[model samples]
Target: SGFLGFVALNSEFPQVNPAGSVLLPLLTGLFGAPVLLISAFSNSSNIPRQERRLAFPSVFAALKGSIAGFFVSIFPGISSGVATVVSSIGERSDRGYIVTMSSANTANAILCFFMLIAAGRTRSGASDALKSLNLVPSFQEIAILSIFSGIVAFLLTIFFGLLIAEKIEKIDGRKLSLSVLVFLTAIVLLLTGLQGLAILLSAIPIGLSTHFLGVRRINCMGCLMVPVMIWYTG
Candidate 1:
């Protein structure tokens, strides 16, 4: 039924000008909005005070993730999710798994640029957007910018993480969730107008059901994947 709904949406897709007109709002509602909704309505307690301690994973775990990420970068069909799952074989600790997954995602982001330069192909959305905008950079430029931005991002993450940790317990989760939902709706309206809002409104219920119905959220990906399958098969 979800797949059928996705098929029905294909007719509406062409009317939207760019596919992103549908995708941006639909995905936000399908994936993002439900999360906020749950947080808004749930009886979740305030976050616990976080300890200012770091738990670094073993070097071997990082190396394994990097290798898995590189493997995913070189392949067209393989996704980072799949790579992370595969790389997590024999993982015994939750912390190690978290570290491995994070490492794989980070490595995949950085290595994808090298893949783009080497193959003149877009392996990720960022690379695809760069290609679309005709803003592809040189190999050296990519290397330098990637490293520099990575360092900045790392620093910012640590800074903000500590800041958030200190104040997280004081935050009202429900209010924050409601605020985010409003902001998300506003952005959708701004970017795609009434039509996108309609799409977003339609998707929120479906997204909510995936959680309440005990179904996997990943199935929501069919909203995009099914359409792609139809396009290619046709």
Candidate 2:
């Protein structure tokens, strides 16, 4: 829905014209509201009484973090991409621009979906843990908190998004910096990407090793502070 909103607000095709921007928020709300409703319904649906007692709150916390992260990552990318494409195509009855951009988005979403499916299959232990943990939001207090938290997060997102939009509107795009810093950073990441991947892969083992040595995760973090600082400085 958010992605659809972005496309509506920033598409280059003038066929939709002024309606596009107006439709963005409306469609976003329409499509997105259902997800919350469905999530609530699904969380509340049939469950064993015993499991429901323990599952609801735990699942709520896990989903809270996961959903927040998912939106944070998705919203910015969609907004940025849409804005870039719109600005590039300009407003001159260019249908191809919007069509091509939308197609790209569709393709990207499909690829990401496939990647997630593949990744899900590989995470057997995590899957098992998830399966063992029931996810019924049964308790009244838990349900209320879940709804409240969602509302707060939604309001916060709107507030911040508007603030950012206002700030960005004041900027003169012609004077904006198009620096090589971004390119350089990308190149650096590309060159060292495999090393970073390896580091992440070894994270669990490294923690286990440290634990065996009677060292804490905090201690490991502290030990890496100097090197991380140097990397950042460079």
Task: Please estimate how well model 1 matches the true structure, expressed as its whole-model Cα lDDT.
Answer: 0.75
User: Candidate 1 has which clashing residue pairs, if any?
Assistant: none
Model 2 Cα lDDT, one tens digit per residue, 105-147: 4333333333234443211212222323433222454446546
* Backbone clashes under 3 angstroms, per model: 0, 0
> What Cα-based lDDT does every candidate model obtain?
0.75, 0.34
| Superposition TM-score, candidate 1 onto the true structure | 0.76
Positional deviation of residue 180's Cα in model 1 after best superposition, in angstroms: 1.9
**Candidate 2 wrong stretches, greater than 4 Å:** 1-157, 172-177, 180-234
Clashing pairs in model 2, backbone N/Cα/C closer than 3 A: none
Per-residue lDDT value at 176 in model 2: 32
Best by TM-score: 1
Candidate 1, residue 25: how far the Cα is off, in Å = 1.9
Residues 46-142 of candidate 1 have per-residue lDDT tens digits of: 5667777655577888888888998988876345665687788999998789878988888888778788888986666567556656677888998
Model 2, residue 84: distance off in Å is: 14
